[model samples]
Structures are given as structure tokens and as C-alpha cells.
Target chain A: MQFIEDANKQALEIMQTAQPTLVGMGIAKDVVPGMHKKLVMHAGPPITWDKMSGPLRGAVIGGLIYEGLAQTPEEAETLAASGEIEFDPCHHHNAVGPMAGVVTASMPVFIIENKTQGNFAYCTQNEGLGQVLRFGAYGPEVVEHLKWMEKTLYPILKEALEIHGPIDLKNLIAQSVQMGDEVHNRNKATTSLFIREMASSIVKTNSSREDQVKVFDFLNSNDHFALNLSMPAAKATMDPVGKVKHSTVVYTMCGNGTEFGVRVAALGDRWFTAPAEIIDGLYFPGYSMDDANPDIGDSCITETMGIGGFSMATAPAIVQF
Target chain B: MQFIEDANKQALEIMQTAQPTLVGMGIAKDVVPGMHKKLVMHAGPPITWDKMSGPLRGAVIGGLIYEGLAQTPEEAETLAASGEIEFDPCHHHNAVGPMAGVVTASMPVFIIENKTQGNFAYCTQNEGLGQVLRFGAYGPEVVEHLKWMEKTLYPILKEALEIHGPIDLKNLIAQSVQMGDEVHNRNKATTSLFIREMASSIVKTNSSREDQVKVFDFLNSNDHFALNLSMPAAKATMDPVGKVKHSTVVYTMCGNGTEFGVRVAALGDRWFTAPAEIIDGLYFPGYSMDDANPDIGDSCITETMGIGGFSMATAPAIVQF
Candidate 1:
């Protein structure tokens, strides 16, 4: 079947079926408080060594460690083959993933709820590194770090956010746009801006300066963490408009860590899925696309919300600093 | 007493010092309708005609054409020497120009307002094509296009923005963070996200289909427009915070078409200015950093908001995308 539509037809169809509404929006409500919220963090697809690329393997191994299913890469492999450990696509949870997307449940997830309509969305916290479990890097250090983030960081942030009240993601998004941030690939300004606002509150809530430092370091280390908050924000925005009857608006574009899927706003949450393609991007040293895996993760919510590749033109210096 | 501090110290000191905050960052807002927002755009330093670099010269010629100050390269030279046109630093107007940083009164500027404080800041709009205007090319097509953006594009956008209500920049920043955008060099996601929001309104307001289409084309064509928006947002946020006495918050760091300048929160709007140095970056064909001018423009608002180089970790694809 021909999947591509002519620009004119596409535009007409889009205009007819889709009212240019916001979709798949959510906020990192985890940083804010008591606003009743419901979020959905999808599961990743299952894949074995044969199906995995190098980075994918690495990410998987990292997941095993993060989940505490294995202590080492060797053990991770053995555990996977024995089926002693679970393997599932993030999509199982209605989420998307990037290269080697892998998220264990314990990982903190953002919960976004729409204020206008009572809809919501969810996504895991950012892993804070290029090569991560969500990215398919199974290693001891990776596991330990994930454990720490979940055990220490996520809870702290969740609690702090609760006390902080509802963080208005719309505000952050607007501010980010003005700060030279595209919100998908360049979130430094957003994250920093967020931290600036919440740092004092977070510090006031935490008894442990060490934890505060850790949180700050982690936040400072990962410029995309605020994105964790914003995804839910986008998710919240998208959910209200997602229920339009017979609408062509995209509701969700999730990756189950195996295939990429979409749910039309008019079609409810049922997804139209396509096998995920490997993302072509620069790799870390000693790695290449050959080492990349099928795109996985809930991050594509950015695109559903009208960001990501759709806006690449805004950032021509993308390939370089 | 010398008010100027060291670069790094000034960064900290501006935020630390007590001073009045500047408002309305970005040129688009400050520009009077029908009056091209004019700021003198300058470069790192002066260069001899014989030493003129390709991209730098090309940018100047583009600037000339954009300003309609010259009919041709030969004519542009005459105009430049005739003293019929003004050559001043963008900083003088409380604005910035990036790259070659050449600003003519005819060039469009972003106007940003601090909602709470009512401070204003301005910066010229992005030229779209690489190695143009800011890179120091003076020519006719450039001038005509600038005129078009001023006469046609800017007014429509201003009205649409007004109708849309004030864009909540903070909200975009937060959402963009989750989308993997850092609000700096990689603003693709942020850029597209904003366009998606504003497109419908812009279409509704445009009188003729052709006019609407032209504006759409311009918005879609210019990737850097979102960057313009982001810069102003950062300026707005940082401006208020910088007003805090001895807060040590860096409010502004920008190049005035010819020089790099910084304004500490403590220092208020006092510019600690210096000659802009050439940047080290990948350039287009037949151009290198050697062919480039000193980095100019209020684009540094990204840095002020903590993206650009600050959050390089988020986009590991830097220098590799």
C-alpha cells in the first residue's frame, strides 16, 4: 500500500481530520505537588542478543543491572537466556524509546495531567547519559547508577515536586522557546531554567545536603531531565484533544523498544504500529550506526507534540556545538 | 573605579551585583511597525578589504542588500563609504547581533518584554541562510528580503502573537527539555513546536492565501526563528533575576555585531564589552572559521539560560550529528 500522500491531499486531509490541536503533551508534574495525576509509562519490546546491536546490547545489559537482575554483563546474558529475567518492550506500557530504549518500572516517571480537560500522560525520567539502559548499555556502572537514580533521586524529586505544587509546563515550554531551546534536541536552557526555579524549594525540602548535591549534580549533568517534566506536559496537552471522534490528530507515537507505534486521536488509544527503524545519529567514540538499535522509548512524544525532526530546521548547528 | 570585571567573574558578578534589569529582549518586539528595527550590527573587529574573508564578506553584502542601502556590491561599497548609512554596535541599542553582527536600522529585531518587570530587550532576527548578514555580506537580494520580512512578515507575526496572548516561554522550555532539546545549538524540536502552535493562527489572520503561504514559507524556511524566540525568553527570565542586588546572576552576555559584552545582574545593563573573537565551528563550503567574523548577536541569551555550551552533555551528537 502506498503510505505517502501528496502534499495537497495530505494538507487537506490533515485540515479536515485534524484541527491542528496539541497532542501527547505532559508535564514533569513529579516536581510539583498534589495535583491529582495519572500517567502511563509504556514498556519496551523484547529483544535478544541476536536481535540486538552493540549499543542495544549495552543498553540491555544496563537495564539488567538497573533492575538488579544481573550483577555483570556475563550474568545478564546468562539470566536472559535462562528466562530467569523478564524482557519486554516499553510499548507494552504505551511508551516510546530511543536507541535501545529500556526502562525498568522502578525508574522515576513523569506524570502530566491536563488542566483544561482531565487527561494525562507518562514517561520515564531521563537516564542522563548518551549510553544508558534505556539506550541499551548493560554494564555494572550503568546498573548501579540507574539503581541510585531510582532509589535515591526519583523519590527525592517526586517528593520535592509534590511539595513544590504543580509546575506549569506550559510556562516552561514558552520560556524554553524564547531561550533558544527547541525543547526536543536542545533542552539545556529549559532544564537549567527549571532547576533555577526549583532548586531552593528542593533544597528546603531535603534534609541531606549530600542528596541535594547529588540531585543538583545529576540535574546539572543531564540537560534533558527537564524534558522528563515537559514530556508529561506535552502529554497532558495532547490528551484532552486526543479523544476527538474521527479525528486524524496523532494521539500517541510510542516505541515498544522493538517497533514504533501511533494512536490516532480519533481512534482512541489503539495504536497503528510500524517496526521501528534504527535512528541515524552520531555515536559515541568506537561506535557507529551499526552499533545502534531500533529506536525505542517514549521520547517521540515530542514529535507527536510537534517538535523533534519536524523542527530540525530551527537548529542547523545541530551536528556541531 | 573600573566597573569591568574578568569574563568569568563578570558572569558571576553581573548576577551578583545589584542593578536595574533591561526588558524586552529580542528585536521582533521593539521594532515599530513600518519602521525597520535598526541597530548598528558590527563584527569582532575591523578587517581590511584585502583581508576580508569569504563568508564574512558575503555576510556584509547580504546585510547591505537586506537594508536596501545599496543596489549592488559596487553600489554597496559606495554607500558604506558615503557615510549615508550609520555603523554602530548592536549593544548601543540594548540589542545584539550574532556572527558578523552587522545591523542596519532597516534590519528586523526581536522585542522581548519582562512581564513582571516591564523591562525590554532587543536583537535582530536570524537571516535564515548561512553566512549571510551577520557573517558580513552586503548585497541587494539581502536588503529586499529584509524589507519583505519587515513590511510583511513581522507585522502579521506581531498580530498573531498578540491574538495568541503572551507566549508562555517557561512552559516551552520545560517541555523541550523532555524532547531532548537544550535550547541552544539544537533547537529543532523547540522551533518546530512553536511553529506548530502559531501556524493555524497565522493562517487565519492572513488575508490572502498567497500572503499566508508566503508567511508560512518564511516561518517554515527559517530554522533560526525559534532561536530568536528562545533568546528573548531567556533574556526575560534572566533580566528579572539579575535585578536582584548582589545576586551574582548573569543577566546578559552578547556580541554587539562587533564586540562581546556582558551584563551581570548586579551590573544591570552596564555592558562590559570586548572585541568579539572568531569562533571555532564548522562552516559551509569554501568557508572556514578563518572566513568567518567574530560571533555576534543577542543569540547568547541561550548561554545565559544555560544551554549552548553549558548543556553540551545533553546532545552528545554535538560535532557529530
Candidate 2:
């Protein structure tokens, strides 16, 4: 009991003091070390194409299409099955993604620094709901949006940041929580705060007013702008605390569509894994629970940080929704 | 008693729902209606040159110098004595200022709109701390900083804002209060949040990187950047509530160096004035409490809005400071 109490103290201290800052945005191959051609980072623990869940496999096909590695989904599927591409979990590269969480070398990623611990984490830009690459429904629109983000939004944001400097995500998160956001499933407040913070810098960049409006309009229209940011921030915040020995506290939690996995502080990098439970929520139109994949993505990072599902009590309104 | 209760309820409702948004920044002549070339605005109720305090007189001199109406403090004093420079309280012009709170033509000012009420308010940029225009010391250095703010900082912020859009100060104030700021004498958190929100946009503007750094460095070093904004926000918040008739609740309070004044809701803009009491706080080195100026500035707006001194119980740590 004493050991558990001491461990809980250290875990709580890390949760309390974690300071995540949004430092920059850049290409995966350029910013993320060890990222190279033919290397793909996906959500959850390592899994092969044979064992990959349907949504995960769909996301990989979409990634291939986005990277222009294949002319069609069938070709991409064939190449993926041939095992010619190297696949690793996003966690291994200090990166995270939602749903299928497929990350290719060319994708843009947010750079989050754990200022308190001097470590870093990364997450791809949120594709924004319905038919996004993360959820495995990669179509022409997904590819176009991803390309647009890469070509226009990413560089403008980079220049704007060069002018402004890093943003302290911990401070933003605290403000968001107070404004009624758990920051995982419901990021309305954080997203608005992010837009408010970035709007000024985005306007000052070399981008045209039309382009700036496009960015702002997209951000204003979507309430998930901070979802990717929160994931990386949570991961960075929990990293150092996870290293405390003899601590029984949970440090990391995730799902890969096929398995639910958690990293316990005492066990170091070892993952405790189990079959992912069937998702039991209402689905979109033309979709049913039968079509649902098991729990997936790196979003559990929010839960690990004591937000998301863990903070449901503070957000009865969202629970009602 | 019932009338007072109704007025208090109205004030509370306004305080709870006031939405002050920073819509623009511009020259006073262009932004503030009826702000002509020769008119000057000061803090608190109207007072003649003979009745003004030393610091107030000194600040008026500084304003004259900054406006190029006079070349020297002696020349500025002569102009005031001649009664050629018309002096009106800032409150009359939908503006507020701290201490001497002097404003002259050509100085840049923030344009804040109360979106809920469709009314507006104005305030000049902060001159920072020590030996500044608002505090009554208008040295060459004071004039220099004021000119720089007008020429450089103001335009960049203006352009940046044009690109981004208006910022809601009511939202910012709510967040600041939660983060340990009464936003009157202690605006540490509000200042940091403002810099964070503006840094990126300030960077994107036409200003050179070096100039941007100068602006950022100045803002980073000073914690009073939000003081000017807070004053205008408070005024805007209380404006609607102050319109309630036959109510005895105080709507606004301020002091020039020579007279303290209150405006009751039932009395409209008519000021009830008394001799301004000398401040009794500990003095700086080489100065006794006797050297302290009478309670001055339009900062009483914060207290009127139920913050600052009125919210002291919410912040014990600041009381210790």
C-alpha cells in the first residue's frame, strides 16, 4: 500500500507539472528522426499487414495513395501485403495519430516539446471528421485536404510560428479544461483557443488574405483543430513520469483496432495487451454497430493524462450530448 | 432599498454577461469621435489647471510635447496656463487612462467594441512602468517610447488584427481571473496570455524581425500590457448596467490627483466629487509616504466591474505579494 501510495504521488506530480509546448510544424521525414522512404508509423503496438484490422489496413492504403506510391487502393493493398514496406508503431517514434493512425514520411506533423522534461512528441494534423484518413475512409477529398495542408497550411503556420515562437500547450489545456473541454473527445474550447492564438500570426505571414481566410474558415468550421495537438502534448507530458521505477501508475494507454494496450510505470516499456472490446456506440448514417471496428488510435493519450474519458464527471453536458 | 437591489442585480447581470471585444487599433483623431487637433483628455472628473496635482500637470506637459504642440515642458506649461489647450475627462470621450491618464491627438489607441451593447471605448497603449507619461514623468525617454508605440507597435498590431479579426476581451478576462489575476494592480497572467495570442501575428506583419523582437521583448519584460485593455473592458462591461434608472448603485468611480469622483446610475453622468485622498502605501527609496500622489487614474473601473480590490479574497497569494 505504501509503495502504491508513493507511486501514485509521483504519477500525480507528473500529471500536475507537465508542460507541453507547441514548438513547430514540419514534414515527418524532415522533423522526425528515423523516418525514411517506405517507412510507415501506425497507431498501437507493432502489427503486420496480415493482422491489421480493416480500418488500419484501409488507412495504410490511403497513406500509399497520398504518398503516390500506388495508383489505386488495390495496388496499395498488394504492395502492403508483399511486406516491401517497413511498418512501425507511432509510439516508437514519439508520434501519435487517430483511428488508423497511418503516418507516411511526407505527412506534416506538429512538434510538441515537454518543456518541463526537455523531451518531445509528434502528431499528424487532424484531417477533420467524416471520411478522414485516420478513420480509414480515404477518398479523393482526403488526399486533396492532406495535400492542401501540406502545400499551403503547413508552411504558412511554420512562418507564422517563426514570427511568434512556441505555444505552451499546458497553459492552453488548463484554460480549455476550465472552459469545459476534456480535450480528447470534446475539444471545442481548445480548438477555439488555438484559432484565437494562431489567427493573428497566420494573418501576418506571406500568405494571401484569401489563403489566410481559407485556413481560418477551416479552423472556425471544425472543432477538432486541437485534437492532434492534445495527443502529442499528453504523450510528452507523460513520458518522463513513466520512467519512475516502482510506480504502479499507468503511464500510457492505446488501442490498435485489434488490441487495447497500456504501459505501466513499473514495467518500463513493456505493454500489457488484451483483445480490444467491440465499440458499442451509435454509428453514422448507413453505418451500424456491426460495421464498427474495435477501439483504435492514439487518443487514449488524453485518458492517460486524466482528461477525455477520465474527466467525464466534469462534463455532464457532453455526456448528455 | 428595493431600487438599490434592482440596480445591484442589473449591475451583476451586466458584469456577468458583458462582452468587450478588441475590434481595432488606430489614431485617436480617426477612431474617437470629436477628438480634434487641440483637445486633451485626462483621468477622472473635470478640473482646471489651477486645481490639478503636480503629476497630472506634468503628464499634461508631456502630452503637449508628444503632440508637438510645445517643444519644452516650460512651453507646455505656458500653453496650459494660457487655457488654449482644452482639457476634458477621458470618461467623457468613452476612454480611460491610469494615473494622470493624459491623451493628445495623434497618439494611437485601442478600439474596443462592446458587441453585446453596440457601444465602444478607447485607451492608449501602455507606456510601461516607471517615469512614464501616465505616471506624470514625461522625460525625453517617455516621449521617445510613446512615439515608438505610435509609429511601430501600434501599426503592426493593427495589421495583425486586420488579418486575424477581433479578440474577445471578456473571454480573455474570464480566463485571466482563473489564472490568478485581478487585472488591476496585478496583471501578470493576462499580459502573458496577450503576448502568446499576439506573438505570431506580430511576427507575420510587415515589421522587420528585429522590430518584432523589440516589440516582443518590451511586452515580455512588462506585465502591464493588459492594463489598458482591462480598463476599457471594465468600462464597456458597466456601461449597460449603468443605464438602469432610479437605482443608487455606483456605476463608475475615478480620481484625478486632486479630486475623487463617483457616478451613480440614477444620477446619469453627473459626478459626485470630493477631495482626492493622498495614497498611504509604502513609498520608494528616497521618498516617504508623504510623496505619494492622491489616488488617481480610471483604474477604479476594474473594481467597479467586481474585480481588482473587490476580488482580493479570491487571490490570497497576490495579497501576500
Candidate 3:
């Protein structure tokens, strides 16, 4: 049998939903474009001093202060240098953070389990961006947004999902594709469809409009917002098959809140390092490429599977980066 | 060596969007339960004498009158007997009619293509049920509604689809499944999503609220309103495979608007007739199996490839017919 068939694949074991792998204790890192507050979580790969980028370095310093590991950016630099604080990429530990990839402990992550496969992964919600942790921008606003996502959006989504049971990603992908989504670059149909499906449940379960709006805004915020959903889905998909022994399918491409790397299933989690590719996407009328940072998380596999860029033909209007 | 694995056997060819099938015009025969005055077009599965329900028979007479084949119902009956007028089932010809699948040569239809599969089928716009032809209800109201759909709904959809291009059935199926649709039954998500996608295009192309509202009302009226879309998509998928020799996949199933029949690739185009099985679906509450027509039309095969009944698991709320 082929290691994996593009037409379809079976989830061998259903991963049950569980507690967030890095909830309730992560240090806030800062922010980045299309993402918010960064926090330092464990990593699947390690990095030496030379590989860090300005955005990633900025995130590390910011995460230290958020976690109270250091009182100032200077102090945080010392802390990381002293190696007293732990530094790990989000992917190694079954999690992925958005740009800047800073996932701190105590940050309540939405832990996703592939139901047909016992593999699991975690991700934080997307924050409406510009000067956020994932964008390598750190300050009061980033932390506050992170606080809101953790305190508000996560709870509402988690509760609604529990009541609704598993949100079948495969099923959603199929329906979304038919409705005009290729499932990677364009998710307007998928996102709107998902919100309408669960909106009733959210309204019924959450008494406050403010609370309900919090979740809604998060989902409706960014266009790449569905990227979060697609990432964990790919991670969960790769995790199970990674153990198949010599299977060439890719498992994880991640960051240590510092540098980028890729992991292959056949290589037994052996990492292949490469500088993250520069993002090519539409910018604000005044903003251009110099403002864009290199790729920062493990969401790349979404492209490998005939989606994202592969399915760009389905979305002719996707803004060119 | 599996029939399904061979691209020439089971793979559906892509469809082009410009030319829609089921193009001929037709007069309505009333088959509605609680309404009247609706006209429609149908595709595929030819129907013949002795197979029609009484309401349908009455509709045919009315159609002859509408077409001016006879001056009255009594005269129309003579026309049918003399074979002076046509009485072909819509499905027998790559088309479908609303309800009793009524059609006459004059109504306009939406031409959607399976661009990726190069196969096509057609259906008329929905006539709102209160006075529509599909329910076996016939009269001026049915005729007026048919006019409205043709004049209003069809144009807006045509323009919107033109701007957006072909609607991909595979993607739609995936999204629908995730959105909690078995596609056939629970399509709340799919229907809503499609509306939102087309809303912008409608706004841009259709300046008349009257026309816009007509399509809107029909879509919001029934959950299965998107069923027409699914039919053409299934048709396109089946066409390529149907032409593949030695392929065992069944290509067509129809009731000729009266008797149920199936056509398989390996078995050739010769239709094997079967007594139409009773259909199982929600009928405007209070209506029981006594109210349902036997499973008719080429529409049911949409379920065979994992939609409709095959996807019952996705929509648990569907009632047993």
C-alpha cells in the first residue's frame, strides 16, 4: 500500500480530546503579523545562537518579560543566555504557535485530537494583528488580547465543541471544497459555514453577548484565521502516520520560538533545518515585503496536500503576497 | 485491477461552466399537495404512460392545454391519446422537473457545469411551494412563479456563477460534511454558506431587490434547495465513468417520472426496471408514506457515492420515510 494516498487516508486511532498541553502557565512572548501575544512553549527541535531572526529574537525577549522571567528586555536576554529558562519549539511538544511561534505555559491552547488516529496537536487562536506577539510586536495590547482569547474565546469554543461533539475536519473540508474553498488559502466559505453551524450552540450555551462576540470576532477576524484550524489538522494527520516507520510523509515543520526546521516521518523525527521561506501575500496599500517576516510555524504541510497554494486555482482572487 | 481505481472507469471528468444542459422549455403539470400555479423544467429519465399518478396525469392534461395542444382538459386528453403532443419525462433527457418532474417547452433553466468533470445535467429554478408545479399544484400562480424564477433567480445565479466560475462539487461536498450536512438532509450549513458566497455577486450584478428576494426566499424556504446543485454535480461525476467500458459503476437511475430504473456501465445503457420504491424523507409534517411518491427520477444516485443516504451519519436528524 502507498504510505499515504492523496485521494484519502485512514485515521488509525481516534485521539480523544484532552487538556491543553501548555495551558495555565505560559510566559507571554509578544506578537507578530496575523497573530497575537507570543509565549515560549516546548519545541520539537533545538537551535544554536546563530540561527535566530530579528522577529524571533524579539519574541523571545518579549515572552520572557510576559512570563516574568525577566523584568526588562535586557534582563530577559540574560535569562535566555543563562539557559535557566527552558527554550523549545512549539511542535516537538504537540503544539504550534502562530508567527513568532511564541507559546507560553499557562496559555490555554485548544488541544485537537485526530479521532481516527491517536495523534494530537495544539494551537492558540488567531489575534487580529499588527503589533501582536506573533508578529513579534510586544506590548500591553498584545498581552490583553492574549488574555481575552484565553479567558473568553477558548472557553466558549471549547464548551460549544464539547456539546456538539467532534467537529469533523474531513467532512468540513469536503463541503467547503464543493462550496468553493480549496481548503488552504481561501476559507471564507469554510469559516462562515462553521460559525453558522455553531453559532446557535454558542448563543444557547453562553449567556452573555459579550462572551459570544468574543468568540465570533476571533473566528471572523483574519482571513488566514482558518490557517489555525488547518495547521492542527495537518499536524494531527501527520502525527499518526509518522510512526509508520520509513514512511516518507512529512510530520512536522516547526520553530523553537527561535529558528525553523522540518521533521519527516520516515526519518524518525529527524529534523531538517532551512531558513523559513519569505511569505508572498497581499499587503496593505502602503505596506510591502520589507515589512513581512519569514514563515514562522508548522503550517506548511497544508500546502503539501493539494491545498493552500496547490488549490490556488480554486481561489482566483487570493491577494498576491 | 479495481474498477474504481482505473481513471478511465470510475473517475469523473471535469465539467465546463458556460453551457448548461436540460435546456428545452416545457409546460407545467400540477403535482403539488397544498398549492398551485407553478411551472418547471426537468432532466433525465423518460417517463411513459400508465406510470403517472392521477395528479400527474391531471397535470399533463393541463400542460397540453397550456401549450395550446388542446383548448380544454377534455381536448387535451384526446391530444395525449392521439400522440399529437409530447409527454416525455424530463429525466429521460439529461434534465429534471420540479416535483412530479413536470416540463413543457418554454421555461428557462440554470446551466451549471462540472468544470473539473466535463459532464452536465440540468434543473429548473425552484417555484415557491405555495403555488408551484412540483407539488402537483398547477395554475396561473404556478405559471407566474415559473416566470419569476426564470426572470429573476436564473439570471442572478448565471451572472454570479460567471464571475465566480464553476462551483466545485468535490470541495462543496467536503465543506458540507464538515458543516454538518449529509448534503441530502442536513444542509443548513451548505445552503447558508452558498447564499453568503453568492450574496456579494448578486449585490454587484442584480440591482433589483425583487429578483434578489425571490431567489433568497426559495433558498431559505427549503433545506434541500441546494439539491439541484448536487444533482448536476453527481451527473457530471457519473458521465465520464458511464462511458468507460467494463466499468461496473452504475451510471443512471431513474423513475421515468413513473417507473424506477437503473443503468450501469458494464451492463450497458439498457435500463433495468424496478418498481419504484417508496421515498423516505420529511414531507411537510403530517404527510406520511401515504403522501410520498415512489422513489423516482435519476436524483437518488447522488446518495450512492456518499451523499444523500450514504451520508446519513452526518445528518442524524433526517426522518425515516
Candidate 4:
């Protein structure tokens, strides 16, 4: 019991002191450990193509097309069923993703580093709300947007980050918390603060005026733009905690559309999983529980460190939404 | 009393419905009515060169150097003593300014339009905190910074405004209130929101990356940047309210470094004046009440509109500062 208590204290201390800084960005295949052209990383526990939920399958189809491995949904489905493409949890690759959380070879990802522990974590840029690839909608528009992000947004942000050096996410998250942001569902203040911090560096980049304006407009329009950063910040922070031996602390919590899973600090690589639940909360017009995907995404990692829903009182405005 | 009540109701209605929009920017002599090359504007009620406070005199000297009217502070002082500059209150020309509140020919000013009333108000860009022209410190660095604003900040903002059209200050203020900004001393939220709104247009402007980054860095560094805009917005909003016949609402309240003044709606342009009182509040390090300047600036226009100190509850964070 004493050993467990000491281990738990070590885990807590690691979580508290971890300084996650946004260092840079790169393509998933190049940056993420164990990532390769044929492997696709997703949210939560592993699943075969046959057992994947509708949203998960849709995202896989979209990812395949985005990667140029398949031409259409039918083609993507056949390729997925051919056993050539490897499916793995984002956790295995020191990464996390929101919603369907699919990461293909060519998609750009934010690289967050825990300066204290010398560890890195990765997450893709958020595509914003509604009809996005994350939410299982994969039309031509979605693929085009992804390509634009790869070609336009990626280079601009990468250049800006070089000018800015490393941005301290811990300080940003702390400031957002004081400004009534839980750093989860209500990220208006967080996004605005990020825009303020990045605006200077972004302007200094060699990108064209049109491309620069497009980046600013894209960031300004998406209140959830920082969600991707916060996820990896959380990932980078929590990953070190799992290295504490005999710790009973729970670090990783996420759901694929089909299964919910959590990893305990002491358990190393093993996972405890259950059936994913349907979310029962407010929905957009013409949508209800029946239209909902099973609870999904690596976003619950925010709560593992005791923010998000655990500290919802900090963001009273979220209730109105 | 009943007639006064009805007139006050009219004034309040006009104030409530006023939509102040930031339309553009221009040199004082070109845009502001009655602004001439020899004429200069100070805050609050009318005053002569001899009666101006130290800070006011400092700003005037800086303005002279910036306008190329005088080469040094000694020459500026001699010119002022010789009565070459015609000094008047900013209110006389439908304008407002903070701190020392000095405006001179060739100084760039923001054009705020009351879309509801079709009237305009103007104010110069904020020079940021400490040893700047607004506080009346006219060092060479101050002069150079002012020149940079004139040559660099002005042109980019002018071009950006053309592309952005009119930005709605009322809506922005309403949102900032919810985000904990009184839009006076605590304009952190207001300034952040403004940056987010303008970043797109700023990036789209033809200015070089160096100039664009300078603009963003200046704005990002100044938390009180929107104070300049808010004062003009309040001025534009209240100017229309004064046009209501028989209205008894106390609309205009401001202070020159030497005197405090107020104007009621029914009283037309007449001002009731008293000797200015020194401000009694927190001060920066190495300064105290002993070093306090007499109450100054047209910033009370915000308080007249029931914001600033009047709506302090909305911004609890101000108390910390």
C-alpha cells in the first residue's frame, strides 16, 4: 500500500510539473513513432475492419482516399478488408485524436514535447465542426479541405512555429482556465488566446498574403482549433505518468465508436475495455440520441488529468451551448 | 419632471440603439472637422498652452517634433510660449483621446461612425504603456515610435480597413462584456477579440512581412489598444444622444489635466467646469500618489455610457491589477 501510494504521488507530480510545449509539426509518417505508410492510427482500443462502427468505417474510407491508396468508398472498403492495411490505436504511437481520430500517412500533425520529461506526443489539426472527416462525413469537400490543410495550412503553421520557437502549452492552458475555459468543449477563450500568441509569428512567415489570410480566417473561425493542441498537451503530459511503476492512477481514456478503453499507469501496455455508450446530451437541430455515434475520441484524456467535465464549473457558459 | 423623463428616455433609447462601427483611418487635418495645420487638440474642455500640465506639455512637444514643426523640446517650448499653436479640446472636433489626449496635425486617427446617426468620431492609435506620448514622455525613442506608427502602422491598418469594411464595435463590446472586459482599463478580452477580427485582413494587406509582424506585435503587446477605439465608439454613440431635444441626460464627462468638465444633453455644447482632482488609484512600480497627474483624458466617455468603472462587476479581473 505504501509503495502504491508513493507511486501515485510520483504520477501526480509528473502530471503537475510536465511542461508541454508546442515545438513544431510534421507529417504523421515522418514524426510519429512506429508510424508507416500501411499503418493507420485511430482512437481507443484496436479493432478489425469488420467490427468498425459506421463513423469509424467512414473515417477509414476517407483516410484511405486522402492517402491515395483507394479511389472510392467501395475501393477503400475492399482494400481495408484485404488485410494489407494495419490498424492500431493512437496510444501505441505516442499520439491521440478526437472523434474517429483517424491518422493516415500524409496528414500533418502537431508535435508537442514534454520539456520536463523529454517526451513527445502527436495529434492532427482539428477540421472544425460538422461534416468533417473526424465526424465520419467524407465527401469531396472533406478530402479537398484535408488536402488544402496539408498543402496550405501545414506550411504556414510550420514556418510560424519556427519563428516562434516553442510555445508553452501549460501556461496557455492555465490562462485559459482562468478565463472560463475548461480546455475541452468550451475553448473560445483558449482559441482567442492562441490567435493572439500566434498572430505575430504568423504575419512574419513568408507565406503569401492570400495564404496568410486564409490561415487567420481558418483559425479565427474555429473555436475548437486549440482542441488538437490541448489533446497532445494532455497526451504528452500523461504519457510520462504511466512510467511510474506500481502506480494505480488511470492515464489514458478514450473510445472508438465501437469500444471504450482505459490504460492504468501500473498496468503498462494492457487495457481494460468495455462497450462504448451512446452520448445522451444536447444535439444540433434534427439530431438526437438515435443519430449519435457511440461516445468517441481521445478527448477524455482532458478529464484524466482532472479538467474538462471534472472542472465544468469553470466554464458556466458551456451549459448554454 | 415628466417632460425631462420623456426626454431622458429618448436619450437612453438613442444610446441603447447606437451602432458604432470602425470605418477607417486618416490624418487629423484631413478627416476631423476644424482640424488645421496650426491647430492642435487636447482632452476635456478648452485650455491654453500656459495652463497645460507637465504631461500635456510633454505630449505637445512630442507632437511638434513628430509633425516636424520643431526640432527639439526647447524649440517646441519656445513656439508654445509664443502662441503659434491653437489648442482646443478634442470634443470640439467630434473626437476623444486617452491620458494626455494630445492630437496634432498629421497624426493618424481612427474614424468611428455611428451608423445609426450617420455621425463620426475620431481618436489616435494607442501608444501603449509607459514613457509614451500619451503619458507625456517625449524622449527620442517616443518620437521614433510615433513616427513608426505614422509610417508603418497607419498604412497597413488603412488598407486592412478598406478590405474589412466597417467593424461593429457595439457587438464586439457586448461580447467582451461577457468575456470579462469593461472596455476601459481591462480591455484584454476586447483587444484579443479585435486582434482575432483584424488578423485576417491584416494578413491580407500588401504590407511586407516585417511591417505586418510589427503591427501584430504592437497590438498584441498593448492590452489597452481597444481603449482608443472604445473611447471613440462611446463618443460616437453619445454624440447622437445629445441631439435629442429637451434631453437632460448627463452625456459628456471628461478632464483636462487642469480642469474637470461635464455637459448635459439639453445644455448643448456648454460645459460646467471645476479644478481637476488628482487620481487616487494604484500606480506602477517606482510611482505613487505623489507623482499622480491631475485627472485627464476623454476616457470618461466610456463611464458616461455606463461602462468602465460603472460596469466594473463585469470585469472582476481588473481588481487584481
Residue-by-residue lDDT tens digits, candidate 3, B1-321: 665456333433322222223222222222211112322233235554455665566667655555555676677666666644555545444555444666665444545454544455555554544655655555666655666665666667777666555555557656666544676545555566565555444545544544544455566565665666666556655655566676666777656445676777766667777677677756777898887766644456566344776776545364221
Q: What TM-score does chain A of model 3 get?
A: 0.78
Our model 1 lands, by Cα RMSD against the true structure, at: 19.4
Q: Point out where model 3 deviates above 4 Å.
A: A1-39, A42-45, A48-50, A61-78, A254-260, A286-291, A304-306, A319-321, B1-190, B193-321
Residue B229, model 1: Cα distance from true site in angstroms: 1.2
The model with the greatest TM-score is 4
lDDT of 2 at B177: 72
| Better-scoring candidate (lDDT), 1 or 2 | 2
Q: Which residue segments of model 1 deviate by more than 4 Å?
A: A1-321, B1-39, B43-65, B82-84, B238-250, B256-276, B285-292, B316-321
lDDT of each: 0.56, 0.82, 0.56, 0.89
- Candidate 2 lDDT for residue B110: 93
Question: Each model's TM-score?
Answer: 0.44, 0.76, 0.50, 0.94
Q: Lowest lDDT 10-mer window, candidate 1 chain B?
A: B17-26
Our model 3 lands, by Cα RMSD against the true structure, at: 13.0
Q: Candidate 2 lDDT, tens digit per residue, A46-69?
A: 788998898999889989989998
Model 3 agreement with the true structure over A1-321: per-residue lDDT tens digits: 564542123323212231112111121322211223323553335664346666767767766676666777788777767756665666656666666666765455555666655556667666655677766666666666777777777677767666556676666655555544665556665666566555544544543555654465556555555556666666666666566564555566655434567766667767887666666767789977787666665555566343666766555354221
Higher-DockQ candidate of 1 and 3 = 3
| Model 3 error, position A197 (Å) | 2.3
Ranking by DockQ: 4, 2, 3, 1
DockQ of 4: 0.63
